[model samples]
Target: MIPAPFDYARAGSVEEAISLLGSDPDAKVLAGGHSLLPAMRLRIARPSMLVDIGRIADLSYVREDGDRIAIGALTRHHDVANAEVLQQLCPIVAHAAGQIGDPQVRHMGTIGGSVAHGDPAGDLPSVLLALDAGFVAQGPTGTRTVAATGFFTSLFETALAPDEVLTEIRVPKATAGWSFMKFQRRAQDWAVVGVSAVRANGGVHVGLTNMGLTPLRAVGVEEAVGGGADPASAAARADEGTAPPDDAFGSAEYRRQLVKVLVRRALEEALP
Candidate 1:
């Protein structure tokens, strides 16, 4: 079905986009149109205005900032996959991006849009949570930083205000041990369960995907790992805090079981 008619405007800059959004409460920012457009066409999302920001080319690059890497909001999945810096410093993101969707979706979906959308099943969110990235939002007042740990409040919900636009993501530099494991019934389907891990200094962090209302870190497992538990023993705590949902695809119990198995596999790969 065709999407409902909507007004369109291409913002020359992020400030322009923010102004546009500020002008209309129901206005939506169109980054790459990969997620928003599909939702619109299916009537799942009905914004009165489409503020196209894809042409705001200035916000579409990757750079190093001190010990962290700053990725512009409009950076496409393919760009991140091809980024040598991310591959060297945060390969887990690249690996997860490579596994996001088929080539077409990856070719157009913006990283900022994906993270801002706050889909618990999306690979990027869980990876960012595991990496403890920071999201930067710009608005009429000024810019503010939000931690990935609390950015996502629930499925399809975020801490962003209506007048604000996410402009960039910051990932701390770390060439540490990490792993990303996902289980999907089909190649392009959302993960039944996914896990991301990163080892730092002396401990490991593990984040669960599609397991709860939001991307969740398996902190219990991390605590165990920190306390010198064997990988096998630590992974046993993967579902200690998660409450997976039951659906047509699989039961909640099945997802919890998958979390245990996937987390175990990811921990083994992340262990030094």
Candidate 2:
């Protein structure tokens, strides 16, 4: 299938991108275009205009900002995978980013684009949720911070407004002892069940991807573990609040069970 014909424009700055999007309701921002372009090619999505932000080179960096790690929106997965700073500061995100699509996709997909897409199956959303990451967005109104948990709303939906552009991601640097595990039918496929666990502030945070309508935090499981529940017992609550969809790979019941198993395994891995 061929994508619908659309006007194209390169945005030189964040302000320019925001203004472009605000000028047209049917415009879409292009980062690496890994996820958006495929949908466009299939005609599953059609836009009147495309505001290409790939040319805005400033939106691609990883820096230490006080107690937080600041990630520019256009940072590629390959960059994250190979960064010595990420290796020492947040190994889980680096490791998970490496496990994203194949090498080509990693080189082309950006962290901001993946998380901003708000796919329940994407790895970064769940990991960022577990790490309590914050997103920074700029719009005509102003810039504001959105916590990761509040950023993901539904399937392919996000907190980003039509005229807003996500500029950066902020995650606490104090997180340690993190583990990311995804169970897929094959390599380079979306996870049937994925878990991101990290130790923070004397408690545990766990996030579930592909186990619900949105990337969800396993609040019950976290509380159980923090309350002294054994790994098996805590993991039993992994599916307490999920609504997984049934598809070619697995059913809701099957996914719930997988969540339990994987959460238990991940908890053991992170806590050990």
Every candidate's lDDT? 0.90, 0.91
The parts of candidate 1 lying over 4 Å away from their true place are none
lDDT of 2: 0.91
Q: Candidate 1 residues 1-272, lDDT tens each?
A: 79988999899999999999999999988988888888898999999999888988889988888999999999999999888889998888888889988899989999999988888888999999988999999999999999998899987899998889899999988677999998999997778889999987679889899888898999999999999998889888999989888998789999988888888889899888
Model 2 misses residue 252 by how many Å? 1.4
Model 1 lDDT, residue 225, Cα: 94
Best by TM-score: 2
The weakest ten consecutive residues by lDDT in model 1 span 171-180
Error of 2 at 216 (Å): 0.5
The CA lDDT at 99 in model 2 is 92
Tell me the deviation in Å of residue 135 in model 2: 0.1
